[model samples]
Target: MKIKNLIPGLLVLFSPLALAHPGHGGDHGFESGILHPLTGVDHLSVMISVGILAALFGGRSRWQMPLSFIALMIVGGILGVSGLVIPGVELYIALSVVVMGLLLWRSVQISHQWVTVLVMAFAVFHGMAHGAEMPFNSHALAYFSGFVLSTFLLHLSGIAIGSAVLRFSASGRLVKALGAVVAMLGGSFLLS
Candidate 1:
C-alpha cells in the first residue's frame, strides 16, 4: 500500500480512543502508568499538542521538544516521589494545555531552544502528577516506564497528524482551526 493511503488509517488510529477515566487500584504499576495519560484529558491534550507545536516549529524541534518534555518529566517525577511539592502543579498542567493550544492556533514558529524550555517547564508538572498519584508500594520503575512509553507514542501520534495535515493542505487554516478547538477544550477543562 502507498504511504499516502496509510495516512488516513494511521490518523484514525491516533485519534483519542477513550473518553472515560479508568478506576484506580491499589499498587498501581505499569498498567496504571500507561493509563495515566490516557485517562487524564489534560495530560493527553497537552502531550499531543506539544507534538503539533513541534511540527509548527518545523525543524529539529520536531524531536527535541518531545525529548525535552520526556526528560524533564522524569526530573519532575523524581521530585514528586521525593515529596517535594510545587504549589499549583495541577493548575500549571491544565494551563500548559491552554498555552499549547494557543501556540498551535497561532501557528507560532518559535525558536526550538525556547520551545524546549517551555515544554520542559510544562513536563515537570505532568511528571509530578504521575509521581504524586502513584499508588503506594507500586513498582516505581514499571509505572514510570509505562507512562513514558505511552507519552512517546502520543507525541508520535500528534506528529503524524500534524505532518499529514500540513502535507495535503497548502493553507494552515485547518491547523489553526484544530488549535482553536484544542484551546477551547483546554479552557473547559480548566474551568472545571
Candidate 2:
C-alpha cells in the first residue's frame, strides 16, 4: 500500500491507545508518558503547528519560540503536578491548535518576542494537560522526561516539514492547505 494510505491506518490504530487513561489499571512509566502526546490528536496537531510556525519565521523565532514553549510547558506541568488548576485548559488547548494553524495558513509575520510569547501561552495548556493526566504510580521524573522528549521530537518533525516546504518554490500553497486541515481538526475537537 502507498505510504499515504498506510499512514491513516497507523494513526487510527494508535490514536485510541494514546487517548486511553495511563494509570487506570495500566502500566505506567517512561513509556506511558512518551505515548501520552501521541494519543491526543489535539496535542499532536498543536505541537506540530508550533514547529511549522517557528520554521516559517526562521531566525531567532525558530529557536526562541520552541524554547519558550518548552520552558513554559515545564512550568505548567509543575503547576499541574502540584494540583494547581488553570481554568479552561482544555478549551485553550484546542484553541491553540486553531490559532496556530491559522497563523501558519496566513504565513503571519510578527516580532520574535511576540511569537515567543504566543507559543509560551499556548504551551501552558498543553503542559498542564500532560501534568494532570500523569499516573500517580508512574515515576514522576521519568514520565516527565518521556513526555518532554516526545514533544521535542514532534516539534522537530514539524520543523523539518516546514523547512522542506520553504525550500520548494511551489510548496507555499501546500503548507497553507495543511494549516487549513489542522484548523479544521482543531475545530472538531472543540465540537466534541
lDDT of each: 0.80, 0.79
Q: Write the per-residue lDDT of candidate 2 for residues 88-108, one digit (tens) a residue.
A: 888898888888777778775
Q: Give the Å error, residue 45, model 2.
A: 0.6
- Report the lDDT tens digits of candidate 1 across residue range 3-109: 99998975553344432234543256888888888887788888998888877677888898899999999888888888885988877886887888777877865
Q: Which 10-residue window in model 2 sums to the lowest lDDT?
A: 18-27
